[model samples]
Target: MTAPALPRHRSAALAESLVLVGRSVRLSRRDVETLVMAIALPLLMMALFVYVFGGAIETGGAYLTYVVPGIVLLCVGFGAAATAPAVADDMGRGMVDRLRSMPVAAAALVTGHVVASVARNALATGVVVAAAIAMGFRPDAEPLEWAAALGLLLLYVLALSALAAGLGALASSVQSASALTFFMLFLPYLSSAFVPTGTMPAVLRAVAEHQPITPVIETVRGLLTGAPIGSAGWAAVLWCVGLLVVSSGFAAWAYRRRTRR
Candidate 1:
């Protein structure tokens, strides 16, 4: 033999993942309504928070500055949640069966959706940041801080997308997949993404502070606004890494179980 077959198969799997990622991205582009809503909903929420609710909220500074990071996470939530339906559609329509009959690797299927989710979230985030800036959401972050924030966001999106893909695999129908992924969109509301966690009641505040989203939001906020990150950055990293590992494993397992011959 020329070399180990395992390495060759690994290379083939990577190639398949890249090709499927392109397919997923193209599918997303064709679905203009979903893409538009993913961006527009976040912008509308940002505007509502900045103009409608900004006056009432007290974050010790401009509300726009305080809330933009939260909105960024919310945008991520919307973008990542879309992966569930896409994967679900593929499964329900027998696309997965067709792919499975080919040389396609099961991991590549979920990887494609997760990568596409990250790409969509990146585009939506850029739009949200631009709109927020136009609406007076100024950030004092240096380039390094901005890089850190983006890196953390990438991790969070990867984790959520993997989780969404797993949920999609486990769902019996596309409608059920949509319902399963709803928690991704609702989770930010319970985080410090909007108002300060201190404003909530004791139990709600405890939940908000302890949840995965809160530390991620806090880390992003601190990076952008020059606030002290302290331990939140580390916590965010740990949370993202943990979620990514667990969700990825779950996605792989769920895909196998759903597609077993």
Candidate 2:
């Protein structure tokens, strides 16, 4: 008797990825802490910085205008870090092992998480922007400039999310994943997020000028304030693309390596 061949799982990878994205989104929505982190925390930080420190921090213009863009970028970075624990949780609970045993595509697992993280970050960005507008933070950007700023933010978030996923896959446990990924949370402090890097000490200024976050923040700030962006816009693009390529490659390698064990 001739046996019929089984259907290939590759044919359904996109569908499987979508299903997993929905699952991840559902899980995020159900968690109160996730909600707070994605929405409430950014809003709170925006208010605190713009209201409390806005007066003290003199940027030669409206401090609210100077800081709102940085706040948005900070929210995106936090959103990216949020994925590490989620990925680690799946690995810890052996959910990934069971998925590997199924006919699902190998890439779908990470893709689903990535897609969900993007959606989550978008919402978080909206929340932060809306709160900023309510608090009198106005950017002098044209509609086209606003769109460009958003595109830059999306690229940055995608790259950071991939990097965080790589960290998660490399970690042996959720605790380690959380700790390992803490760098992203503090990275903005070293750059131009809260203040101008020019005011930093010479050594600090050198680092802030050279690091990835500074260019990104500078690009966004320039776009919003109608300042000439110079080479920062291109630098931000290169940094985001380069980081995405490296981190995504590392994430795939780490996922395969972890699954083989």
Candidate 3:
């Protein structure tokens, strides 16, 4: 007898997962609101902070300009948090096991979520940028430089998404996944988000300046303002790459642990 065909390890290639994204979401009209809830809320928070505290706080420039990038990162953070819950739910519902047994690509399980999140994040970023522009936040850099900044931010988001995937894979329940994801949103505020590190306490400032977020914020601000990238610019990229590689490995391992008999 002829040998039976074996299934592919991953449900789909990374590219194919793009189409699968958002498919499981918004199957009905009411569910479409998640787009706004996930993406628009951050921009709304940006507006709230800028208008409420702009005069009181001094960022050495337009408050909106200084704060918007941080807000974008925060959005990414909150967006990633959603991943864990969704993944946990799928597994709890036995959906993940079913998919794994099928001919689907293994990577598709995570890529589908990541690609969908990118779409939501892209929309969110657009809204925030438009609001900033309307409020007189101008980009001093050339279009290409602006693109570079956005590209870096997107990569950072991708890394965070992978990290969240690992968390989801490891979590035994949905409650823990939801609870654990809060750190990403909380950390940026502790950085140079609303205020410059120079204005913070001496010890806090030291830590903030050297942290991963400071480099990212500094790089994005420099690009947007046509300022210098400095060492932080390169560091930001390196940290993102480091996080992606490490977390991706863990996520893969966690998935196998959860799936393999």
Candidate 4:
């Protein structure tokens, strides 16, 4: 009970949590249909945006180039939100409670879901990027720049999935997670996902131009195209960090509360 022992115990808990996350990832691999469904929707978005909808949208840059980054960002949100319903499903099924009762690490429970979500995000990103390239969008950035853009895309997902997993855990059901995810997906779609901020309604355009997703999308576009990677890029990073911190903290608190009860 001594305060001096608290830090050591917490460290041990963290280690256990990480291991559980790994196990969660392994178990998720067996969930084939869920895996496929997660990848499919985002891929469909990529196809629809690039082919079916590309002509109608007029981005300032070449359509594919501009669209690629936005889709990438959108998928990160998609992947994160998509996982929420799964978590909710598990809770309703009492799988989560069963895990809580086991010796498995609590953090691992979150970690596994996050891994699956990220894996799905990567697949989504890959499909979209491949389709974009096929449609004539070429990334002209230096090797390092390309890597940076890819890293940012994944980083955003990493943060988002962590937050989403927490929400999913606390959610009363998977349906609730779906509603929450809709808001997450809606933010970027209403923002700079397909078209320029200038083209939106003046009020919406103002918000779209300044919202968290816009900066990240714009940053990726610039990086991929070797255009100026501006302040918006940094703003995008800050947004990811901020959201991650807030959602992750809340999820942790919620999980503790749930477990304690």
By lDDT, the best candidate is 1
User: What is the TM-score of each predicted model, taking all chains together?
Assistant: 0.96, 0.93, 0.88, 0.87
Question: Per-model C-alpha lDDT, please?
Answer: 0.91, 0.85, 0.76, 0.76
> What lDDT does model 3 reach?
0.76
Stretches > 4 Å off in candidate 4: 1-11, 93-95, 102-105
Question: Which of the numbered candidates is closest to the native, going by highest TM-score?
Answer: 1
Displacement of residue 74 (Cα, Å) in model 2 is: 0.9
Candidate 2 wrong stretches, greater than 4 Å: 1-11
What residue pairs clash in candidate 3, if any at all? 10-104, 10-105, 10-106, 11-104, 11-105, 11-106, 12-105
Worst 10 residues of 4 by lDDT: 1-10
In model 3, the runs with Cα more than 4 Å from the true position are 1-19, 22-30
Q: Residues 32-138, candidate 3, lDDT per residue (tens digit)? A: 66566777778778878889977789776778778877877777777766777666666677778777776667777777766566666676678778877887888
Candidate 4, position 125, lDDT: 77
Clashing pairs in 1: none
> Per-residue lDDT for 92-196 in model 4, tens only?
776778878866566666666777778777776787677778768888889898888888887788788877777787787778877876777888887777887
Error of 4 at 155 (Å): 2.4
Residue 200 of model 1, lDDT score: 92
Give one clash count per candidate, in the order shown: 0, 0, 7, 2
Writing each residue's lDDT as its tens digit, candidate 1 over 120-174 gives 9999999999998998878999999999999999999999999999999889988
